[model samples]
Target: MVSPLFITTFTLLFVFHLNHTSTVRPKMHINIYMYINMCSSNILTNDCLPPLNDENDFLPPLNDENDFLPPLNDEIDFLPPLNDENDFIPPLNDENDYKKFAIKIPEKWKKKEWIKWMKQTEEDWLVFNTYIIKKKKKWLARKEIKWKNWIRGMEKKWMHYNPHIYREFKSNTMKKSQSWDDTQWARWIETEGKDFMEIEWEKWIYQNNKYINEWIMNQWLQWKNKKIMQWLMNSWKCEEDEYWETWERSTIWEKWFNLRKRRKWLRWHNRINKETDQWNKWVKSKEVIYTKEANNKLLEWINEKRNSFNNWKKSFIDKWIHKKQWIVWIREKQNLPCTI
Candidate 1:
């Protein structure tokens, strides 16, 4: 019951609408692509993006929904603009500037904060060091001038206070030289040339004998003891010849000779007493107080004398002197019989 004209018109309008959408869809896609390309290419221009209804509406989607945005504290928000001259971060190319900023860092910062600050400032420090190295010669020249001025001032003050410093310095140098002569050089000479030194000393003593005698007499007058002089003379004589005849004739030798004569007489008397005891049959022997060491020494000496006498006896027999004359000579010399 619908009119034919109305149905035809409705169908034609729907076909036309489909064809227009198909043709325009591709053009719209192409326009969007061109717009994105233009925006990327002119990103720094003011007209890069169409104005948005809200600035936050066009933000890219983030991976985490709760990620923190920048702090909006008044201190940060009200900071001078980045391009402002007053807020400009000066290049830390000067050493003083680097030290100033470095000293400003707090000592109590956490490790992560310290690391972050070091990473941020490392480039500036390197740049400042390079600048210093490039100007090193000029800096050193200035330092040298300052050092010379300070030295000159010190010298002037020293001269005002003590004008004898140079003389004292020279004296110290002489003392050092004298010390070397006294210690190291003297030691070297003593060690390396000892025989040469001994010969020189002998020559000196021979040359200076008159003076040395005078000095000895003066020393003896001061000491006033003949024993010391005797000891010195004995020592000198011993050094010349230890077994000299004069040394054998000393007082000690005389005392030893007398002791030996008494010992021999005692022995002969004891022998005579023993012979009489054999006849009388009851005479007791005398006791001598000899220490163990003295007895051992006496025995050794007696053995030595007995061996010598035996050697002489053999010689006498070979020479045909083992007669009555030899027996009488032995009795006179030792007071003992030659035979048993």
Candidate 2:
């Protein structure tokens, strides 16, 4: 039911709009207000038709399953260590597990004295084994040192061609203009246009042997000055640290009296029979087979092979380790004097 007055007024406005506008203008312009209202109502009632994929629209959507992720796993996550549990750790691994120590006394034998003996024996065996290990370590260390010396000698021989490498190093070291005071410092301009003085004494001067020596000297002088002041004040007690006449005249008090006594006794004991009695702290040096010694020993052996009597004597003293029929040979040749 369009009102005739309203329709007539709209037709007159449309004609006026056409007369003012260019050729691009349409004959009539639809009222957007009424069209928008109508379209919205139809959509709400599904008369305009819903989205094609309305089923997906109702349900929730999922992620791509390969989107931006958080931080990944670590080594501890895959194979958690044994200590991850609250239990205490067990005993150590041993290359040479001497079963003698591992041997345990039976439950029935626990009452016997052999149980205690076994424990003591095991401890003693362990101590003895360490001695063997130390000897082995010493031997290995000596061998290593020898090889090192040989390598060092070769390096030195090569370096003789040009000794300037060390000189160049020294020059580079000297070129760094930083003095002791300014070694850890840098000059900087301040915000106020003045020089900034950042004195980081902690990082600048670390505790070292040189500083220690200087400190000790300063301490000694300070102590001496204090003592002199006390003497001048006439307040120096005779027995400042002891029962005495004057601090200096009193019974001599040695800081290392006990230490001196121990050293004196130790030195006196050292004068006694040393070869059999002394347990030397010095490790016995390795006896490396030098070329001269090896050659001499080899030549003597070869010479002994040539001599008729030496040959016969050598047969008797022949190494039995390689001989297969050694047991039978020993029985048949009973008179053959054993050399080993």
Candidate 3:
């Protein structure tokens, strides 16, 4: 026979193992499944005992169809749908909908405190203000004509009170207005004839009354705009060709300037040509003189220094013979005449 303490210890060990682990179908010798079914049935109805299925998030199958539990997949609220059309999901609050749609309400719903000052009159507000001011002034004037007349006389005396203010107000309101330029005169003359009397001029002008005039103005405006743009582009700080105008070159009197510069340049060229001809004659004469003088000097030098002078003069003469006299003459005369 097994010892009683050993049997008790073995039973306690098995119970602890079943409580702590999964797959705890009691592996006893007989009627194992019957015991499990009875235990499950007892566990469901027992309120004091916490659910074993609660840990695994399991709920019992519901028998009733109209239960509040959410439907699977395409889940919707079950109680009631609150839209005129089934297609719309109704926003619960009407005020929220009004704000969402940006609806404007009447003046009665207006929120401005200052609106209390706006009086309700029989006439439209715009018209009524004018009548009210006129009526007030007329009634005040009739009741006190002497006072009004006195105030009118005082207007002259009031100028001394604030002379600058009156002067400024008068200057601002009373302006010397300028008439517009005669646009018809300014627009390019339409016909070969100057007057409006020519048959072709009249016909052409009549044919192109409104439409063509606008087109011409647009073209002129475009041309002027382009010219201004080009001038701006080709200014000193720019990188394009310029549109220099008569006004822009106001400092330059072109017709007189062109004539002046032409006369000056021609005069200088004439002087220079005379100088160049004279220079050439002088150079040729010097060449002969130099040849003679150089030969005489070479002979005298040779006589003085003998063979040493011959050596130096030979190199000098060689260099002189090769030298371009014209080029040298121009370089000296014009100071950097060569393009290079």
Q: Which stretches of candidate 3 lie over 4 Å from their true place?
A: 1-257, 300-340
Show model 2 residue runs off by greater than 4 Å: 1-108, 113-120, 123-134, 137-144, 147-171, 174-340
Range of the 10 consecutive residues with the lowest summed lDDT in candidate 1: 282-291
Which lDDT tens digits does candidate 2 get at residues 1-340? 7565565556456545544542221211233233334453432233222223333232222243222222224212122233322221234254223221112112122122223433554465356446544654454455445534643453343222223423532322122322412212111111110111112112212322234335434543464355334432321111111221122243345323444323323332342223113212111111122123433543453344236333432342232222322333333335555443
Candidate 1, residue 258: the lDDT equals 57
The worst-scoring run of ten residues by lDDT in candidate 2 lies at: 188-197
* Index of the highest-TM-score prediction: 2
For candidate 3, lDDT tens digit of each residue in 224-324? 35533542342221210111222234445653455533333333345335534744464455345334543464345225433432343344334323442
Assess every candidate by TM-score: 0.14, 0.14, 0.13
For each of the candidates, give the backbone clash count.
Answer: 0, 0, 0
Question: Could you give me the TM-score of model 2 versus the true structure?
Answer: 0.14
Task: Specify the highest-lDDT model's number.
Answer: 1
lDDT of 1 by residue, 1-340 (tens): 6564554555456445544543233444454345455544433344422343454533443444232234333222223444432333456776556544332222222123324533544454355435433444454355446534643553343222233434633323222323353344334323432333234334533443344334434443443244224432432223322332333456765536555333323333453354345423311110111123324543454455446434543453333222323223334345564552
After the best TM-score superposition of candidate 1, give how far the Cα of residue 197 lies from its true spot, in angstroms.
Answer: 46
State, as a TM-score between 0 and 1, how close model 3 is to the true structure.
0.13
